[model samples]
Target: MQKVVLITGGSKGIGKATGQLLSENGFKVYGTSRNPDTISNHPFKLLPLDVTDPNSIARCIDLLKSETSRLDILINNAGAGITGPIEEIPEAEIKKNFETNFFGPVAMIKSVLPLMRENKSGLIINVTSIAGYMGLPFRGVYSASKGALELITEAISMEVKSFGIDVVNFAPGDVATDIAAGRYHSPLKESSAYKATYGKTLELMDTHVDSGKDPMFIANAIYNIITSKSRKVHYKAGEPLQKFSIVLKRLLPDRWYEKMLMNHYKL
Candidate 1:
C-alpha cells in the first residue's frame, strides 16, 4: 500500500517541493493552500486550507478521512513571518502572527492525532525556523512564534513517543522564498521610533534571502527524516552560517550569544 502524506502550505516553496518530491517517491501526497484555485495541477491532490481557521482545518481533515483510512505523515508547513521590533509591534499583529504560525499548526496536530493514534504509526513534522533558536533584531514576532513552536514540538514528541507516533521540529534557516517578500510591513505611524534601525536590517535580510539555499534542499532533508527508521526530535536545514548560529547558541553564554547575534545582524 502506498503511504499517505499531507502537507500544509504546500502550494509553494519548501512545502510545494516536498509535495513534488514525495509524490515522485511513490507516496500519495496532498498539498493544502489557501487558494486552491491558484494551485497548478500536479500528481498530488490540492486541498484548500487556511491554517488560522478551525473550520477550514476540520473540513480538510474530514475530506482526508473520507478518502484515506490512514495517514502516514503530516507536515505542518504553513507559516508567515511578521517583522518589526516587539516594543513597536501592535498587540493585534503579535496575536495574528501567533495564530497563523503557532496556533494553526497546533490545531492541525490536534485534528490529526486521533487518526494517527488509531493507525498506530505516524510522523508529524513541524516546519520551524532558525529564528526559533534565537532572537533576531527586527524579526522579534516571527522568532517568538517559531520559538513557541519549538517548545510545542518538544512537548508533543515526549507525549506521543509511547504511541509509536513521532513529532519532528524541522528548522530551516533562511531559504530562498517569497515569504521574505511577503513579510508584513508595519505602517510608519505605528513604528516611527525603530523604523530607521529596523529598515536597514530588513533590507539586509532580504538581500541575504535572495541568494539563500533552494527550497529543494529542505524538502530533501525532510524526505530523509520521514523515511529513516529512527526519528530525531529536531532538524536544522540551511547554509553554513545557520548551522553556526545553532552551534554558537550551544557554546556561548546567553549574554555572549545575544551580543554575537546582534553584531552579526549589525543591530
Candidate 2:
C-alpha cells in the first residue's frame, strides 16, 4: 500500500517541490493551501486550508478523515516571514508571525496525533529554518517564530517517540523563494523608530534570499529524512557554508558566534 502524505502550504516554494517529489515517489499526497485553485498542475489533491484558523484546520482534517481514514506522513511546511527590527515591529505583527509559524504547526500536530497514535505509525516533519538557531538583525520576529518551532519539535519528538511516531525538525537555510522577496514588511509608520537600521538589514536579507540555494535541495533533504529508518530530531539543509555555520555555532563560544554574525551582517 502506498503511504499517504499531507503537506501544508503546498502552493509554492519548498512545500510545492516536496509535494511533487513525494507524489512522484509513489506517496498518495494531499497538499493544503489557502487558495486551492492556484495549485492546478500538481498531481496530488489540493485542499483549502488556512493554518492560522482553527476551524479551517478542523474542516480540512475532517475531509481527510472522511476520505482517506489514515495518514502516513504530515509535513508542517506552511510559514511566513516578518521583516523589521525587533523594537520597531508592532506587537500585533509579532503575534501574527508566531500564530502562523509556531501555532499553525502545533495546531496541525494536535489535530493529527490521535489518528497517528491509533495507527502507531507516522512521520511528522516540521520545516524550520536556520534562523531558528541564530538570531538575525532585522528578522528578529521571524527568527523568534522559528526558534519557538524548534523547541516545539524537540518536545514533540520526545513525547511521541514511544508511540512509533517520528517527528523531524528540519531546518533549511536561505532558499530562492518568495519568502526572500515577499516577506511582509511593517509599514513605515509602524517602524519609524528604527527605519534606518531596519531598512538596511531588510535589504541585505532580501539580497541573500534572492541568491540562496534552490528549493530542490531542500525537497531532496526532506525525502531522505522521511525515508530514513532512524528518526532525527534535527536536520539542516543548505550550502556548505551554512552547514559549517551550524557546526561553528555548536563549537564556538557565545562571544565568538555573536561577533561572527555581527560581522556577517555588518552590524
Q: Which candidate tops lDDT?
A: 1
Residues 144-196, model 1: lDDT tens digits: 89999999999999998899899999999888999987778665444378777
Provide TM-scores for the models: 0.96, 0.95
Q: What ranges in model 1 sit over 4 Å off?
A: 188-191
The models' CA-based lDDT, in order, is 0.89, 0.88
lDDT of 2 by residue, 67-170 (tens): 79799999999999888767667899899889999999999999999999999999999999998888877788898899999998899999998999999899
List the candidate 2 regions with Cα displacement exceeding 4 Å: 188-193
Lowest summed lDDT window (length 10), candidate 2: 182-191
lDDT of 1: 0.89
Least lDDT summed over 10 consecutive residues: which range in candidate 1? 182-191
